[model samples]
Target: MEVIAERRYQVRGMADLVLRIGKPEPFPDGRNFLCPYEIDGPLTQRRSHFGGVDAVQALLNAVGAATIDLELCEEVVQGLLSLHGQSGELGLPDPLALTRLRSAGTIG
Candidate 1:
């Protein structure tokens, strides 16, 4: 596996890393599939954290998605929030809680 794409930037004192890892075709046949990208941020380290990776993971878990599709990221977060405690609420129990079901490890 190799990093097909990498994007990094800094915001204030914080830094972020987003990577897309996947296998490549032996030749440039143009039949390869698009690999999912990963999201990484320093929000988890802050006292108040939410959105970013936290939001992405919740959606992956909810949909059991193998790839991180950003298009559905917002929708996934909304859906998770709509399942508050199974009491038919409109928000999560913690409501935008900062947590991660899967850490941003190396992906291929």
Candidate 2:
């Protein structure tokens, strides 16, 4: 999964992205695809849109235009970047594994 931060040239702030991508391709609008993902801008809640600059941007855009919170968006971006960096690392536990461990009281 390739996540890119969506920039609102006219506005500010960002949000999280969860995507269901297929494969890389091109579109009629000149947007390239690594997978099929979309988000528009900040709103009261997350809304789905397409043709974002990247994952972060898609997520931020998905958030809609009604609500734009810079701190929250930046925080989410950092968290996602951290997770992205941890991906495929040998010692790191996956989210499900961490959840299972916490549930079993093996980790807190």
For model 2, state the Cα shift of residue 89 in Å: 39
- Among the numbered candidates, top TM-score falls to 1
**TM-score of decoy 2:** 0.19
Model 2, 1-108: lDDT tens digits are: 343433331122334332222233344566632233333323323333334555444443333321223223433344432223452122222425556888999987
- In the range 37-105, model 1's lDDT, one tens digit per residue, is 354434321111112234344333322222223223332333331222342232213322323322343
State the RMSD for candidate 2: 14.6
Candidate topping lDDT: 2
Off by over 4 Å in 1: 21-34, 44-108
Prediction 1 global C-alpha lDDT? 0.31
